[model samples]
Target: MPLTDTDRGAMLSVIGASSVDDLFVDVPEAARLSGPIAGLPNHASELAVERHMTALARKNTVAGEVPFFLGCGAYRHHVPASVDHMIQRGEFLTAYTPYQPEIAQGTLQMLFEFQTQVARLLGTDVANASMYDGSTACWEAIGMARRITKRGKAILSSGLHPHYVSVAKTMAKYTGDALATSAPTLTAETDIDALIAAIDGDTSCVVVQYPDILGRIADLTPLADACHANKALLIAVVTEPVALGAIRSPGEMDADIVVGEGQSLGVGLQFGGPYVGLFGCKDKYVRQMPGRLCGETVDADGKRGFVLTLSTREQHIRREKATSNICTNSGLCALAFSIHMTLLGEKGLRDLAGLNHALAVQAAERLAQVPGVSLVNDAFFNEFTVTLPVEARPVVRTLAERGVLAGVSLGRLYPGEDALANGLVIAATETTTAEDIETLATALQEVLA
Candidate 1:
């Protein structure tokens, strides 16, 4: 696929660019490398490369190796050994698109189960196989709203993760969708109330994050009702699906679209990726759902069988009829998620959720007792915000040096927002231990003092 001289000239002509360097005009001059990367050779032996990578990897502090407490979207949970064992089987691991029903029954069946589990977990009439991740899934949902409502403007909740908002803004810039965005607030006003009042006749959708980035929870019934009244869709984003086991489901609250990250159940943090996005919605919008949907039917002999019910990607169907040009599931990650959920069952998930909340409460209480620290959330599930007397970013760095992987800092999430510079967002899960909580509390006190 490497471009020949003629091919390169043709591409440059099509884009109205003179040279390859012209394409990088948006990148800052100082930021771009002038020459070869320092200390990196143009060529190396396989053994040498392995050694170099190993040395670099050893410098990173693995979450499980220390007192870790970081969770904004990706989380650290106890993924069972059986989950890995099941996913690595040759037929499952090497599987791809299930186009041939006769030869791909196993893959189709697994996806069917995954879809069913996601629907019940998210409390929706139906759920797609999966999407890229939470952020893309969120953008897809907004696009779906525009298709369903025939409007151009989408109002984003202030509490929506800044990362997700950034992704939406990037997409809206090209698609001509009007995006109304704002920075996060530390005030008493709720995003739900603010967004409900912001809805208008031209609004296509309202996007809200459940147990939003700062880890505060709110009721969505009123907001959903308001969106319906305004002829706008209510899109709920959940960064932590584990919260659903304890809190009310967004679908139950009448959210038109419920999409979230499925990393908490069976997937590893994996240093940020290969995470699955769980997307579900009311039955009325199933046809517009992105990715793929697996369906069940009986054969001529009355034997149950599974098949791909729908695939709206332009690659699969005609371009004009497609809902999304780039829509594909994170198959391996979704399989891991499904295996984990099946193992947990219904009651087990609730019990695991309870343990997470209880541990989070204990950690929050202990952290709040630190000098010059105050709790920011009165209600949260497995995570909360704490305001420190000093800038939390530096304190977090110091804590890391001391072998305590403290939670994410709001300053890190909202880089230049002076209003939230001192706030830190911490998380807890079943993997969190009493000692880990105590270590963070004690380390935080000393660092602040």
Candidate 2:
């Protein structure tokens, strides 16, 4: 049922447009290209293109080949083989959004379990099906906070990921809201007292990342209380949700909204894409929340069924009055997340989190023994920043050449930032073995020498 030329022509004709180019009449002529792109070949056979791309892909070294330690949002957590096996069981993988809940019983059930797990993990009352990714979830949280408080100002902490902050800024620009951001690139050990000072009456939400970029976990209960006193909402952004197993939930800290990336559950870091965005909030703000929510109901047969409740807030019915244009979301990814979480359950997840933290502590201890290196945060969960004698960029490149993935360099993420330029953020998951830690340490020592 692929689109045919006749169908395309008919659709264009129905719109009173002669060609596809006619639909772009409003586009600026300067922006419209006069010709095809120069460097690319005109066309190639399917097999030939596949072979070409395969050759190109083989040139790059994957994470599995090297002792991997890279983590700046995406970590190399060990997902059980069962997680993917269950997700690809045909019934779940092939299912779409539960638009018709009666027919989509499997998907609706998965969504129900996913929502429950997210709510429990975040210590929130309600969670939606899912969003695009962590960044978009943060964006939507700000919007939700604004709607609930009837305020337009947002206060973002410096410890938040720079990319997440940028996304929030872009969303603010579109809505014409006021945004006050702290200094960029703060580690987990950074001063939260300064961030609290930035909150004011007009501030609708105060956003902060848990176990922040430097892997320093913040006890945000005090900050949440301060936000509440100022009549501002607390939007907690968690780039790594697995950290929740060890740390306290944001909702327990009085967070009005808890949004995070759920890729660590079952989603692979497929080159920084296709991650599930976890979103949950206080029950009182469910109406203002974005994304679809599946609820349980009884049918005529007295059997439990799922239905799409509270969808009128979407763009289809309300048009410009819609709470959000995110009518659809990452269905399969969220299902994968739900399946993985179910397989782990509560105790299993807690054990996994403990392993990650223990491995990270071991890695930090070994790396600290190296000369000219200092561990920045003594208190951390699974990741932490290391201050090196020299800039970390060249050091990391040297290690990569030696068949070590190493960790993320602060200089690379924040180009001109001097304080962090010499630091490296390292992570250790259940997948990081002692051999990998040793390899990283040996290579780091060689590079520094």
Worst 10 residues of 2 by lDDT: 182-191
User: How far off is residue 397 in model 2, in Å?
Assistant: 1.8
**Runs in model 1 with CA error above 4 Å?**
1-38, 187-189
Each model's TM-score, in the order given? 0.91, 0.92
Q: Can you give the lDDT of residue 170 in candidate 1?
A: 91
Candidate 2 achieves a global lDDT of: 0.86
Candidate that would win on lDDT = 1
Question: What TM-score should be assigned to candidate 1?
Answer: 0.91
* Tens digit of per-residue lDDT, candidate 2, span 136-254: 99999999898889999988887788889889888888897788875444344665687688888888988998978888887898888889899999999899888889889999998
Global Cα lDDT for candidate 1:
0.90
What would the per-residue lDDT of candidate 1 be over residues 70-181, giving only the tens digit for each residue?
9999888999999999999766673356778877777788889999998888889999988888999999999999999999999999899999999999998877999998
- Superposed model 2: Cα runs more than 4 Å off: 1-39, 43-45, 184-188
